[model samples]
Target: MTVQTTPAGTPMPDTMEPEDDDVKIIADIDEPWLPSILTIETGLPTMGVALGAGLLGVSVNSGRGPLVAFMIGLFSAVLVFLAVIDWKTYRLPDAIVLPLYPALGLAVAAGVAVGAITPTAALTAVISMTAVFVILWLIAFFTGGLGFGDVKLGGLLALVCGLESGYAAALGALILPMILGGLVALPLLFAGRRKHEFAFGPYMVAGALLILLLPNVLVPISRGSLFH
Candidate 1:
């Protein structure tokens, strides 16, 4: 038996190698134009989600009149945006979350200007924000369970909800988020899909929105007086 060699002069086994002409390399097709369009499309769902939340905030604050409703709606819009970004990226940009501090101040000032909130209420809000921030920061530092973004978001929620409602309301706001996050994470843990790390900002945002929308229900719970 005679052994054949390849055109490149390499020795060939009994099985012959496929010719270069028999092979075809397909280049990855690029659609540069589609990405910009897809990017826009991808963002629409997030915007719609945020807008729905804003409308809910408006409806919830309807009893307080249009101006307050509008303010809540605007704040809810920001919250929804933060929640979506954090869900997708697991990061809450300081640029987005930090401006909320001054925006919250302006919100308080607006409430004061319109006689919606008393000076004492504003003071309580500041204290509540500080307390929440410290507590969450400590949790993140010790356990590394929550991120800095969550801490900042918690403070923002405490300020906004506490100012509008009360300290009890702030407590309720914080509690609800933890509950929501835990509820979702528990199932994931049981199914072995996740290993402790999860996006918490969305739950925080949800809790804040819920508290903003239904202070009557959450505030009483926070006050520890269901009958009252």
Candidate 2:
């Protein structure tokens, strides 16, 4: 009789726990109380994940100029991680989601400090976050279909999208998610999973990433690009 342990050496109960080979643990930190701990045993290689994320990040904002694109790229990479974990667990841990509040603000601040981003853009980002958060908060309160996690993630996505364009893009980010989520959900509903809960973070991330990558897309639709 042998006991198995995670690659990180966390114990796995043979009777009650998944097999050691079945999961890879991702901890942004090893702290037990942190929400960054993610145990996903999908048989995917670590290097593969990193490679894919890097490609996605680069592709997402490569047109935003070097500095902005680089930072957005890094954040997009993180979004990839969050998207997968949220899909698998149906929960977006606070460890990753919570920090984006400060991290995104700081990134905007850094941009302003260097003159890459204007103060006006920074303010727009803040407004974007607040607006999305408020709207989603109200939706979650009224509909009971959205969770706090979705609300927070939606706001962060708006923050980045706002930075990329303006308040209009941020608003577009919210709409895109709803549209995309509905597209994904309609089929499931027809398939008879009406009460089924699905992960919404991935669509949120996709909307933000698309907003950043395709800055020209919503330009005519947005009417005025404040940050651009």
**C-alpha TM-scores of all predictions:** 0.74, 0.72
Best candidate per TM-score, number?
Answer: 1
Q: What lDDT would candidate 1 get against the real structure?
A: 0.76
Model 2 poorest ten-residue lDDT run: 30-39
lDDT for each residue of candidate 2 in 90-181, tens digit (9 for 90 to 100): 88788888998898788788888888888887788888888889989999999987889899888888788788556545544587788888
Residue 85, candidate 1: C-alpha displacement in angstroms = 0.9
| 52-166: candidate 1 lDDT, tens digit per residue | 8889888888877676688778888888778777776677778778988997788788887888777887888888888889989999999988999899888988887876655
Count of backbone clashes, every candidate in sequence = 0, 2
Candidate 1 residue spans exceeding 4 A from truth: 1-41, 190-196, 221-228
- Candidate 1 residue-wise lDDT at 111: 81
